[model samples]
Target: MLGSLFQKFKDGLRKNTPTFQKFFGKVGGLFAAKLDAATIDELEEALFAADFGVETTEEILGEIRAAYRNNKDLRGQDAAKIGATVLSRVLEGAEGQFSPNPEHHPEVIALIGVNGAGKTTTAAKLAWRLQQEGQKVILGACDTFRAAANAQINTWAERLNVEIVSSQHGADSAAVAYDTLQAAKSRGYNVAILDTAGRLHTKGHLLEELKKLGRVVQKLDTSAPHHRWLVVDGSLGSNSIEQARVFHESFGLTGLVITKLDGTSRGGALVGIYRSLKLPVYFVGLGEKPEDLQPFSTTAYVEALFG
Candidate 1:
């Protein structure tokens, strides 16, 4: 199972693997030749370039340097193993877990994030995945702020053969959320994935709107929205760490869904984000297919990232 998952990550990251490997300070999945001073310097530069952040980058470099000093015969692959081990340790307990509570007829998952973070698409994909897992699912289109939000979600619902609840543009998003949960409960749906409007983490008013939506959701079932996930743009590098921090502070994120990773070389940004937020990464967008949004697996991730 882990092997297949690793293959999926490799497939997802194949396009950027060249640059991705460099970001790890590796010369082709291994060091250029030997574990020497020049190689160590290159690794540090690569780690920084990949946005590993100072703490993680320093830890990885320190481990490799220590290994190199103790054993002069340490090889490039050996160093890569040490680095991957450090990364896996830092991201321990990052794999998110979720199972709908039967008492809560329709477990709610509110997808939160700023604009262009792939919230809407993730909502549809998540709904589809849950439905495939035999959980009756409904997508709540609460993103009434973006003009194209309705059209986009509606298209996904139709294409994926799933149900959706939406409102007119500029309408009260909270009201729409209420209606969606109401539909889910009445229709016997087990999961309600709400794709809320994107809010700039810096804007208090926008955050207030999200809080209102959360409050409204709880009125139906105090635990209706069981998962509050932040959908982050993985390509944003260390800036994404700040985004996660701010959203986490205001919205109280339960997990994360990193998207657009297939397009970026700075894949180390994910490690930094996790190190800073410590939030479980529930899902990661690997491709455009519905199944491409694979569940986060630390083992698979470290293997793929370093390889």
Candidate 2:
């Protein structure tokens, strides 16, 4: 399963890989040759160009420098091996598995992100994925603020053949969330995925509204809203890290769904976002299809990155 998924991820990431591979190719000669300051500077620039955030890039460079000092005979591939090891270690703390607790009937997952982050589509895809696993799923169109947010979610519900609870335009979003959960409990759905309005992290009022939505869910069931997942645009590069930080602070985000990895060369940005936030990535959107959203696997991701 992971092999096929990794292949798909690799295919989607092909455009980004050349940039990443360039670093290895440039420094491949250095492994057999003596390491010098110039080579290290070039490696740093390559990593930055690959979108590895400064902190993570520095950490990897430090490790390589230390290893080079210890043994000048290291081959470029060996350095690549070392780099992968260091990156895996940096990502280990953020690794986590997301599985719905069977005991928590109607497991609630609220998707949050800024406009164009693909939150609504992710919600639909997530619901479809869960449904395929034989779990009854429902969607909540709680994005009352966006003009056609409800209509978009309703369309997905029809396409996916899942039930949805939504209110009219200009309605209170918190009320929609509260009613969605109430309906989920009464209707015996296995999971309730709420699609919230896309709000910029810099918007304080909108952030407060997100908190209100969470509060309404908790009021129904303390253990409700079991997962708060932030959907981020993978193409945003280092900027995505700031977005994750702000959303995590506002909602205590439990997981992340990175979207649009197929279209950008900034796939390396995942490293920075995970390293900075320390939040597990639950899913990655590889394409527009429902089946394209694959569960996050650390081993597969690292292998694809360094392959």
Among these predictions, the greatest lDDT belongs to 1
**Taking the tens digit of each residue's C-alpha lDDT, what string does model 2 give over 82-122?**
77897888888565676678887678999999989999999
Q: Which candidate is the best by TM-score?
A: 1
- Candidate 1 ranges with C-alpha deviation above 4 Å: 1-32, 200-202
TM-score of 1: 0.92
lDDT of each: 0.82, 0.81
**What is the TM-score of each predicted model, taking all chains together?**
0.92, 0.89
lDDT of 1 by residue, 121-147 (tens): 899888888889999999999999876
Worst 10 residues of 1 by lDDT: 17-26
